[model samples]
Target: MSNSRSTKLHVAMFPWFAFGHITPYLHLSNNLAERGHRVSFLLPKGAQAKITPGAETASDVPFPLHGHLCIAFDQTQDQVQTILSSLKPDFIFFDFSLWMPALAHQIGSKAIYYSVITPVAQALKVPTKQKLEDMTLEDFMQLPPGYPSPSVRIKSKAFEIAQLKVVAEDLGTGMSIYVRITSSMIWSDAMAFRTYHEVEGPYCDYLRKHYAKPVLLTGPVLPETLATKLDEKWTNWLCNFKQGTVVYCAFGSQNKLQKDQFQELLLGFKLCRQPFLVALSTPDGCATIEEAFPEGFQESVKGRGWVYGGWVPQTLILEHPSIGCSVTHCGYGSMWESLFSDCQIVCVPYLGDQILGARLMVEELKVAVEVEREDNGWISKESLSKAIISVMDKDSEIAGLVKYNHAKLKEELTSEGMQERYLDTFIQNLQGLLD
Candidate 1:
């Protein structure tokens, strides 16, 4: 490892083909760039347009077609290699591209498997020698050996376990998702996650011992500043409501719900009887959010609820004083955003990693409440309403406790020099890798 303090390394960013993945890579790139490190970011043209323009990500693609996207992403390997050859960067930071290590080696660059997902999720689903095709629900139900937290175990829920199995299956790619992620870690020069040790230290340490490799932390990778403002229409609407009175619900660009569930979620907001805004993709079989609305839903919630099918300024909205509570799908990026905001959090997770993230929030951190799901993984309007009301109600004890805890933790995380210190140490470690 190099001890030189003045070395500034050129790093390449090639994340998986999802905005959830790409956006974090960009945040890290911005951080590196601010430190005078050269960064070359590579992504598909469609992805590039979405970040710059307002187009949604490939995550909005239907679930059945995700495999095709993976196949296309893999086909870019040769193109990526050619680009790397020309750049000759000192380090390549990537995730989901299991083939990146060899390509980095070809160019004499160190490959860093920089995971945007939580280490708790990775620790629970640690890679094993067993074939993914043969792994059963029982296999996923059992916590991996030496898992850091007993609280983060997979529930006996069939839907959750089934989702895990699906993740382990080949999604049009030749390799299973599990193999793609684990193999990347196994072959990379080092492993890094977009998390701080204060929150996820045990899990990070466990992964280090399990993989026998350097594990680095990037301290949440939040942007230091924002360049944009909330849309005028939203600002106008939210101003009519008092501070901490409106509930905001968004399940991210991905995760289009079933038509039935879509209406149920709307009904949940109506039951809460709070002024609210919901941003979501059109549900399956529905062309617009209005088409999927439950009968009388519009007339009932009339002026109190607004549902939009396009993207809204989420980070800005969360920062709005009127947004008292947020109902999220617990995606990693959203999790960080919610943690940094003052809003009370209610989680309705739809994926494996999201489920684990929700557990980390609700169970481990005690900073949020999770909407209960049925045995088949269906979330009910009543459950959603209950979760939101529990947090939004001023008189509720649980609400006060979670709010206090969340505020304390948020202060610690965003304290002056916290993110800067993490980035500085991370850069020092990168220089060491070149030795």
Candidate 2:
């Protein structure tokens, strides 16, 4: 009884302004709350209402969460000092976009960085011979491609690869340099990341030991796939398709398909002769839906296929036995769901980590068939059709292989060893406070 009041773990959860980043933290917060820990998830205004649980409609006086706002992109000495003075989280956790980290440090608060995308630190560092895996660094090992969770294409046109390269140099990649930089500047404490053990094990291992802070790895979370019921007309139509017969085509929240590209995919689905569901949701200019969908394709397929514009309950769709294949942006959430479902993948991944995600799906997982495109990145209808058929054809060897790999990977990830590893890390993080 005393333990309940004595040890109330409090973690302040802050994610970058994106669903992918926010959702995980929400789950984490919920997990913590279920364990009786205090959780405070902050929203910096303009965040979606769907994800935000009971977000206050208006706030006059500054709330604890939105103490002050400073852009991470504008990381200036004076600006940082100003920002730091405002944020006073006890333990600050956020995606990389927020720059108020230096401020948290000034307030003697610990900071932890979660790489919503794969940590590109060493991965992005152009390898000397082949890649970071080939590096002589004992810590270095082969990294399977890093896939991003599906969401809006979060971008900063002002921020380029060149700018990131500069940021890395300024922050220092190694221990001594990073330590010195942290001491001299605003950010305090170290960072952990989320990636699977089998795939990014070597890199994760190195980071766990090298960083001053303990690393937490929670990868490939398999989302619950059945959100809505099957009685709906669309759900009923999906049911008419044979089990493991319908190919699900969805390009996450952030991905956009030009009408031309959308038509190509539509033709691909038609060519496969596989009943399919396509997710088509874009927010304003970020990923607009108007031009991304083939005109009249909806009308043509009215009762034949489904078109989920936004918030289609992906996990539920993936869980359905009628769904056999997926053509996705390779976002982590969708990736794991498909993988765990052990369905065949027909990849048409696009943008940022998705390129790497596609590589992971097609190259590493070896379960998905990638739509071949020109060097300039044009996915012709013919290539799209082939990809669809390759994944959906009942007798296709590739389809069988994909199903098998998915099962195997799912087993490994869900095994006792992985569970032990996570419990150990969580305990250690809790234990660190004793030190």
Query: Which digits, one per residue and each the tens of the lDDT, describe model 1 over residues 275-347?
Result: 9999989888987778998998888887788999988878899999999998999999899999999999999
Stretches of candidate 2 exceeding 4 Å from the true structure: 1-7, 52-90, 119-122, 126-188, 206-213, 221-234, 282-302, 416-424
Per-candidate TM-score against the hidden true structure:
0.93, 0.72
lDDT of 2 at 183: 38
So what's the TM-score on candidate 1? 0.93
Q: Model 1 Cα displacement at 174 (Å)?
A: 3.0
Clashes of each: 0, 11
Candidate 2 lDDT over 1-435, as tens digits, reads 433334656566656445676777776566556657666666644455554433321121121222122222223335434444455445666654334466566676666665655543424322334432232222222334443222222133222232223322233223222223333222435555556767666555555554545566655443332454644755777878878877787776555555666667676666666677877654334355544556676676665676566567667777777887778777766666666665677766564355556556676567676777654466777788788777666697887787777778778776766744563455356546435
